[model samples]
Target: MTKSTQGFCFHTATSSHVEPLPNAKKAMAILRAAGMKKINFAGGEPFMNAEFLGQLVMYCKETLNLESVSVVTNGSKVTKRWLAKYGEYPDIMAISCDSFDETTNVKIGRGTGNHLKTVVELSQKCKEHGIMLKINTVVNRYNFHEDMNAAIEEIQPFRWKCFQVLIVPEENGSEHTLRDARRFLISDDEWRLFNEKHRHQECFVPEGNDVMASSYLLLDEYLRFLNKGWESRQKVF
Candidate 1:
């Protein structure tokens, strides 16, 4: 049940646009109390609250004596200096990249042309500064069949790359629709086959305790746990 041996742990907070709540300081206190040292900042997008994020990073590094820190980003709102500063604090940067192809990237709601390019460039910058970089891809039916290998190839040079099977929450407020869910839903057998096909490369299954939904924490400038149902899901295969 402890975090490190269990894998990773996640905490969530409400976004500024969504509601008013406790700030990042309170959120960090809660996480520290839970015995978490490594933390991640996720949101509608973390960069929206740049100053607050910078403060949080500084506080966690100095006050909590954290071992590692990370942010899951979209790559659009970050600057080279911000990335560099984030790197200095020993934080890992994981950018959400569904495809390396621009048209496909935009079609999937990521953004217009050169978004992936920007991410690639930023990732390189992160490497130059010795910050860990990870590419996070959400595999779905449209892009799952053919693009997986190419996505891997595009991101292979980075420090880490991860593929997550899309999960649809049954709850009414879930952002995922049944149609979107169906597009990405693969059976465990299919997942095994996909793994086998790409078995030549290293792949990471979420550590026993570090399930993405569980191990990391997300907040607005004011931190809060956004999704509560995630903690109750059955174990992923």
Candidate 2:
């Protein structure tokens, strides 16, 4: 339910063809007008343009006075200096760590061999800056059986979310797409098993396809509304 509180956007997809700042302001105004009080910035790795992302976070809190502003990142590009400058704006910083094992993480394309290390470091920095830390794990074929309890316990995030691997029709399901996530997808039983394994963790929250399908109101790079089902880009700005 925490996810439904915010709308998500792909920053790089929109930034490619438009002036990011103005477009961002317009989008934020529209969202605010629509009574959206919380917004989350996702990628194309938002931290790629750290300053731009920081500005948007600041504008949401200071200018629009949004109730919550969050960022979902891979944690590879985040730096201590950037956190010091802009960390105060975001209410939560969620790092994607698919697996606790470094080898499995690298194979899943989270980062190189050091992604787990980066996540740990970023979690510490977020704590020092008084920002809530969250971990997002996608339970795909490669990481379905991993026991992440020890690492998650060590990090002690405010929330630890596990998502069943979903394959959108035009996005990641087909061979033509950049990611053929068909191979990564796990069965419903596998997802249930994975959740059962971590049920003891206090912070753990598991989301299956049925829940994820209708929960999000996503805006794509072109500022078009996206639904995870048969409809793609239901509305455009």
Tens digits of per-residue lDDT, candidate 1, 1-237, equal 001110011222121452222345665766788788788766546677665666677788877888987777776777777755665774687877766677766656666677777787767777777777777665444444443565566656444344544342432123442123333455655555655555555643322112644654443232333444556433111
lDDT of each: 0.55, 0.78
Which predicted model would earn the best lDDT? 2
In model 2, the clashing pairs are none
Q: List model 2 lDDT by residue over 1-237, tens digit each.
A: 011110111121323433367787787888898889889888667787788889989999999999989999878788888988997899999988888888887777766688877898889889899999999988989999988888888999999999888777666667665456777878899998899899899999999889987887777655667645555455434
lDDT of 1 at 66: 86
Per-model RMSD to reference: 7.5, 4.8
Q: Model 1, clash count?
A: 17
Candidate 2: residue 199 lDDT (0-100): 87
